[model samples]
Target: MAGTDKQQDMLAEGPAIILVEPQLGENIGMVARAMANFGLGELRLVSPRDGWPNEKARAAASRADHVIDAAVMFDDTAGAIADLNFVYATTARPRDNFKPVRGPVEAAGELRTRFAAGQKTGILFGRERWGLTNEEVALADEIVTFPVNPAFASLNIAQAVLLMSYEWMKTGDQAVRPVESRPEPAAKQHVESLVAYLDRVLDERGYFRTEAKKPKMIENLRTLVTRPGFTVEELAVLRGVLTSLEKFSPRKPRGSGAPDAG
Candidate 1:
């Protein structure tokens, strides 16, 4: 099964991810995957080089089909964000414009605040190479940039989307599911019983070789067994393993045993 829960509806209502003249279908698909990772689902494309409904994008998106299937295409940058009340244009290079600039984190927080106020917001991402032109940046209400190495600051189209998507999600309150199911903790009696059984077996095997060290060794053994606070199921498995080891015995080689008789 896919990592997503089909039972729950996708979060398709956050700020739009607008890509201007995106070049690759794979990058578009990957951008969808990244958006899905963080719960933002709206995707807007402006004049994609390979055109819309690209199969290469679908394959690259992994199982994030909802984002790809719901993507909206536009003829130009202006049309892509026409309905949005606020928009942010992302750029790596410093522009000569006077618009307010924000880092990814601050932009995400602002998006959350604006969204709460019932304002529609969107972020504009430029081409895979060269990014948004100065005129395109002017269309946005504010500029958002990344704090990257000044010497080399260019980012992949999908990578830029992922960073912004992640920041947007981080600003929201979402619960993370636990990795594994946890059973009830073992009862105190169950823990003591296992410890007692192991102590008996070890004593029989002469594991506590010296009387002076025996008490400390037993104490250490008890501590080790009790430290983990094993679940009920785990305790049962341990007891079963101990029982099997106690009953096991090595058999003599068949040929050696029957050599004299032969």
Candidate 2:
């Protein structure tokens, strides 16, 4: 049910499925099957080998006849996709000048985010045997790729589309900014407290009295502690560091020549 919201928003932009020059009726039917599984409709066929909307294709599609019924035939790939605002070219390997390669999930996430931000997008999948030509792929706004074991990463076109759809459904509209992930604020606070406790111990041991700029030194120390945005684990680490420093400090308690355990 986690992906239900996504599943329902399935067609936020009424995205179209553009199959550029499918080779077989079975593949078209399979494509239809894949689209139906993910609640995607609007099949745009750019020519075919066995003639589309046929019984063979229908048989392959099975319950996904809605896609077959409404399948729009096109004379060319551009004709099929001319109405789309954004296009994603699905490819397994890089070609035609280095472009940013997005994994299925990542591409879906981005497309969904863009759709939520009001962009009509479509995915451009090529023929199975030869994949998309450089000319066809060049028409796309971005390139989407899948991660697989390099030795055996050949994914069927329908499968590739389904995976991308699954990821897009999961993405929703959260435009998460990529940052140098920091620990939680609460954890950061705990680290700050640990550092404070350390300062108090060092001060009580007269390490600061010997130094004229004690306040400036502690202020600088505070700056370093506050910026980490620490997590619980990070705070624990700060505590460990303080404990180690305390054990190794030159000063000691009145009876043991060790820092006070206070």
For each candidate in turn, give its C-alpha RMSD to the true structure in angstroms. Answer: 25.7, 20.8
The worst-scoring run of ten residues by lDDT in candidate 1 lies at: 253-262
Model 1, span 60-135: residue lDDT tens: 9998888988899999886787667667889996565566789999999878876665567789999987899876
Please report, in order, the local distance difference test score of every candidate based on alpha carbons.
0.77, 0.67
TM-score of 1: 0.63
lDDT per residue as tens, model 2, 101-196: 677777776666555545456788888887897656655656787788899989887787778756765665466434334222432235445657
Position 28, candidate 2: lDDT: 85
Q: Candidate 2: misplaced stretches above 4 Å?
A: 1-14, 173-262
In model 2, pairs of residues that clash are 252-257, 252-258, 252-259, 253-258
Give each model a TM-score. 0.63, 0.60
Clashes of 2: 4
For candidate 2, the TM-score is 0.60
Tell how far residue 95 is off in model 1, in angstroms: 1.5
